[model samples]
Target: MKKLLFFFLLMPILIWSQSNFDKAEKLFQAKKYQEAQPLFEEVLKSKPLDIKTMDYLGEIEAHQKSWVKAAEYFKKLKELRPTTADYFYKYGGCLAMRAVEVNRLKALGMVGEMKESFEKAIILDPKHIPARWALIEIYLQLPGILGGSESKAISYSNQLAQLSSVDGYLSRGRIDVYFERYTLAEKNYIKAHEIGKSKITFQKLYNLYLNKLKDPKKARELKQKFES
Candidate 1:
């Protein structure tokens, strides 16, 4: 009789929690993060180990630029689900963004862990494209003394090419632009635009022509072609 009574008492709370979670999810999807956050927290109070709620909270914190708080949530997620690639990727991304705000020495100290996190994500899921792109940026941005290597960046770019030609060309174009190899960047961007024919690809090629190459005529032609 006591067990039956307890079950009846708990059922309403469970139903209420589920309803709140559903509502919170709708708000989150609508990008009303501020409104969704407190409801998600309420869900967490009822179900502390709720992975979806935790993930949503982490993303909200990240969107709000609360990097340390976001990192804490993602770090917990990675610990809770070690084999999940996206958790590790998000954790690394949070750390990287936090590093940008700290002192250089502190930031440098964070580099190894950031690299390790992204690498671990890749190891867990070989087809993880974002992790590969993060690694490419890390290699390109780090100094040689800190293990920066254009060759390493190119290697990841090649891997991306195998998985996605558009990403491959875009990444190569980015690297070339970074090095001020404008002509080479132009070729890569053009290739990406030809393959993708999307807004992102078109913008990249157009920006390169207008800004770096100083060829407004080419940019105009490209823009006209893309619009038409």
Candidate 2:
């Protein structure tokens, strides 16, 4: 009799929770994140192990630039789904953003964790564009002491080439510019433009022509093409 009574009591709560979750998911799909977040939190209160709800919440926070909170949620997701590449990538990205606001020493401490998570993401899914791009950016931006290496960045660029020629050329161009290889950068940028001409590509090449090469006429011509 007690077991039967407990089952009857639990059924209504489960149904209510499911209803709330479904509504919240609809709101999330509609991109009403602020409205959806509280409902998700409510469901999580009753069912803390709801991974999907947690994932949505993490994404919402990340979109809002709540890096610390997003990192916390993604860290939990990683714990629940250890082999999932997206979670690791998100976790590392959030942590990387958070590092900027922290003390230099503390920021340095997080470099290893960020690198590990990003590398793990790549290992789990080799062709994951976002993960590879994140690694490329990290390697390019960080200092040598904190694990930044231009060679590693170039290696990622190579992988990106195999995956996406346009991205590969653009990334290589950016890296070359960073290293003061202006001529190489200009060639790569032109190749990228030939492959796919977009506003960003035009702007990059135009800027290089105007500022670095001191060719105002060429820059103006490229600008006209972009404007057209």
Compared with the true structure, all predictions reach lDDT values of 0.95, 0.90
lDDT of 1 by residue, 1-228 (tens): 999999999999899999999999999999999999999999999999889999999999999999999999999999999999999999999999999999989998998999999999999999999998998999998999999999999999999999999999999999999899999999999899999999999999999999999999999999899999
Per-residue accuracy of model 2 over 35-103 as CA lDDT, tens digit each? 999999999998998899899999989888899999999999999999899999999999999989899
Q: What overall lDDT, based on C-alpha atoms, would model 2 receive against the true structure?
A: 0.90
Output the number of the lDDT-best candidate: 1
Best by TM-score, which number? 1
C-alpha RMSD of each candidate structure in angstroms = 1.1, 2.6
Count of clashing residue pairs in every prediction:
0, 0
TM-score to true structure, per model: 0.96, 0.85
